[model samples]
Target: MNVGEWAAVIGAAGSLLGGGGFFVARATVKAARATAAAQQAAALATAAPAQQAANLAVLEATVRRVDEENGALRGEQARFRSLLRAFAWTVDRWAGQMHRAGIEPEPVHPLVEEYNRTGV
Candidate 1:
C-alpha cells in the first residue's frame, strides 16, 4: 500500500531467496561429494578381481617351478640307485671269483650288502 511497506516486503522476499539459495548450494555440494565417493568405490570393486587373478597366476607359476625341481631330484635319485646297484654287483662278482680260487671273501660280504638296505 505504501512505498515504505512495499520496500520492506521486497527486502524480506530477497532475504528468503538468498538464504534458500545458500542452502540449496550447500546441498548440491554434499551430493557431489557423495557421488564422487561412490564412483571411487565402484572403480576399486571393478579392479579387485583382476588383481586377484594376477596373484593366482604368480602362485601357479611358482608351483610349476617347484614341480620341475622335484622331477629333477627324482632323476638324480634314480641315477644314485643305479650306481649303488652296479657297485654291489661288482663286489659280488669279485667274491665269486675269489671263492673259485679257494680264497675266503667273507670279510667284505656284509659291506657290499649295506647298499641293498637303502631302498627300504
Candidate 2:
C-alpha cells in the first residue's frame, strides 16, 4: 500500500481500538457504580428496621417514665389538698374560739400584713 493509504488504515485501526477500549472502560465503571449503589441501598434497608425499633424502644421508655412521674404528681396533689383542708379547719376553729372569748375578730389581712412586715 502507498504511504497515505497505510497511514489512513493505521489511523482507522487506532480509532477503532480506542473507541472499543473507551466503551469497555465506560461499561466497567457503570457496573461498579451500580454495584456500589445496590450495596448502599441494601445496607440502608437493613438498618432502617433496626433504627425504627430503637426509636420505638426509646419512645416506650419515655412514656413509662412520664407515666411514673404523673402518678407521683397525682399523689403529691392529693396530699397537698388534704393539708389545705386541715389548715382551713384549724383556722375555722381559731375563729370560733376568738368569737367565744368576746374578742373582736381581727381581719386576716392585718395578720398577713404584720407577718410580711416582720418577714417571719
TM-score of 1: 0.52
Winner by lDDT: 1
Candidate 1 per-residue lDDT over residues 5-99, each given as its tens digit: 54456556656887655555555566667777999999999999999999999999999999999999999999988988787778778889999
Candidate 2 residue 51 Cα shift, in angstroms, is 1.5
| Per-model TM-score on C-alpha atoms | 0.52, 0.65
Under the 3 Å rule for N, CA and C atoms, how many clashes does model 2 have?
0
Lowest summed lDDT window (length 10), candidate 2: 111-120
Candidate 2 lDDT by residue in tens digits, 1-120: 644454455556656887655555555566667777999999999999999999999999999999999999999999987876677667768888999999877777775556436633
Collision count of model 1: 0
> Which 10-residue window in model 1 sums to the lowest lDDT?
2-11
